[model samples]
Target: MHRSRKADAPRADRVGRAGSGALALLAIAATLAGCQRGSSETPTVPTTGPGGCPAVRAAAQAAVAQAERTDTAWDGPTTGPAAVSGRTVVFVAETMTNPGVAGVANGLREAARVVGWDLRVIDGAGSPAGIQAAMSEAVTLRPSGIVIGGFDPGSTAQQVADAAAAGIPLVGWHAVVAPGPSSRPPLFTNVTTRVEDVAGISAQWIIAHSGGRAGVVVFTDASVPFARTKSDLITAKLATCAGVRLLAYENIPIPDASSRTPREIASLLARFPDTWTHSVAINDLYFADAAPAFRAAGRKGTGPPFNIGAGDGDPSAFQRINSGQYQAATVPEPLTQQGWQIVDEFNRAFSHRPASGYVAPTHVSTAANSAGATTWDPPGYREAYRRIWGR
Candidate 1:
């Protein structure tokens, strides 16, 4: 993902971002880049039968709404040696210029300090080559283990194989879902945010908030797994709404998000002319510039489409979520907590322990409940982890 704010800057109602010296090094090279798709065409997923699409869509959307307020159980290691003193661990992130990404890197560093492990991080600059080079450099050190932050597992296959051959346990954080393809070797452990769930949540929000009948434009990006995962899921979810239909899909590349999202959205709206009542974005950043476009496109009287975002809890996103106007709702990922989870997962894997790290708490914030909320990490989470790690 791309980040525009300083990682360490203060938030109006939240803790400052957790970024270390290593994150600063990667910020300069941080311009997100990713694989581009050939086209945006997508056929709606099939949903038919009695009570019809409207009934089904509403039911499904309601389910998501109920789950949004549900709490998830934390299943990661609670009591154990946090780190082996003098051991070295390396984290290679896609980019730290991103506030959430930088926070994750620092979270791992903070946990590493408790257990006394030497931690090193490399920025991949959001490219295959950058990931490979970072992996290579980490491998050269022959560290206790390696962690990949938000890079494709397939792209890092060779490097992963190399690290494994070198007796290093390779773990991933915020990259892939659990039980990843049998075809692709599973990382010793993958610390993840269930993006499918995130997508389902967003889709339902659009469905319920829009009254089960809406025209939506799904914005997807090829640079990150999340964009694809979310786009496909949301598209499928919307398909179940008999009254709802897809207007179009815009696949923006990472480098083009800031410059192209507005133009693409504008063009889509101009062509459709009030057909879309709401829109869905891969993340808040993807829809950051949409309000002006909505106004310029003459989206008055509520017939024009509004937008919703997922992941990366931008302060603005929360504020807008609470406003309930231009920005409807958003799913905020706990970036810092996930980072420390990576270190815990790594520590468990290094000790030849069982799989015990999974970040399982999340929330979707809307205008009604966004007030005074900042992060997804539960209160006393850091204290809980410390006690569990026996630090």
Candidate 2:
């Protein structure tokens, strides 16, 4: 998080600026609280050419077109030690309710079975204390390895240290800021697409789809550093388009998303009735929660407030995209393939080899190319991993 620098000013001027800032904050708070009434008119989309930034629009269109391609080949690791058989593993989930976490866990289970390893999963129930307790239990179980699934490892520092002290190799799925081996948190490797690519392409999608003239709202979970970072990058990219207006930056935690999103969406509809042209969420679940609110507010399923999830393209996201119900696109991670990668990373550890350091490339999925699929299951990864493991 970079902070903007301010020049020195007089005390009186500073006090005046502080007072204005407070008023602005109160106004925003009132809008979010559903106290401010908004217009009932739907936002009008502009059929314009890159909003006067032709070069940016052209680059965005090219990138989005490339990302939407469905014929990407397997580019992950193809060589390593064969499976380390008969080992037991445990996956400590941030919350099974998060489709991303659960999806990866399922992939891990499938790969584990193929590699002939026993696997156990413990649900953290999406609480700090619950995750800590889960981590503690995983360390005590003394499994061959422990997976930090979709939660910050720093939050459970003691448990992670205990696992490391016990010589248990730790692998993470969206666990740390960066992918591939971390020294501070002690992860053998982290499985995730590069956050910058995901964020950049997501924003570019909005630019290309809207012809660089979108009034965008970005939703993110501030509690998770990774989610927050992605949202920030998305905001930065959206700023590149001169005609795109950032209507709002909503911070709704993932666990609370199901409960809070409906009210938030209703409020946003009232507040920015004609200006909120598009939305980009860090996860797709927000749109699922916002569906009823949108319907109640008389917003069409195929909308002016077209939504796109920046990451975690789960089955539900695909359904919404395929049906043209609120969501228009997603930058989906190869969840199942990542799960297989986790197991493969563990095998490398067991074989006394280095982490694969493989980060999946970013891809965007939309109605035109989705082909009625439920998830973005790219081809060749399963077979490639199988051959690498000699299964």
Q: Name the top TM-score candidate.
A: 2
In candidate 2, stretches whose alpha carbon ends up further than 4 angstroms from where it belongs are 1-50
In lDDT terms, how accurate is model 1?
Answer: 0.63
lDDT of each: 0.63, 0.80
lDDT tens digits, residue span 1-391, model 1: 3322112211211110112321232221121112235435433442322343667666766675665663555555567555555778898887765556666787788888877788898988766677778888888889998887766656677888888788888777655544221124457777656655666677777778777667777777744544554565566556656667676767776556777777886778667775668888877867666666666766652334767776676666666666554677777777677767767667677677866645455477765555456555544557767786677
lDDT of 2: 0.80
Position 305, candidate 2: lDDT: 95
TM-scores for every predicted model: 0.79, 0.87
Among these predicted structures, which one has the highest lDDT?
2
Q: What are the runs in model 1 whose C-alpha is more than 4 Å off?
A: 1-58, 70-83, 177-183, 223-226, 295-304, 322-325, 357-362
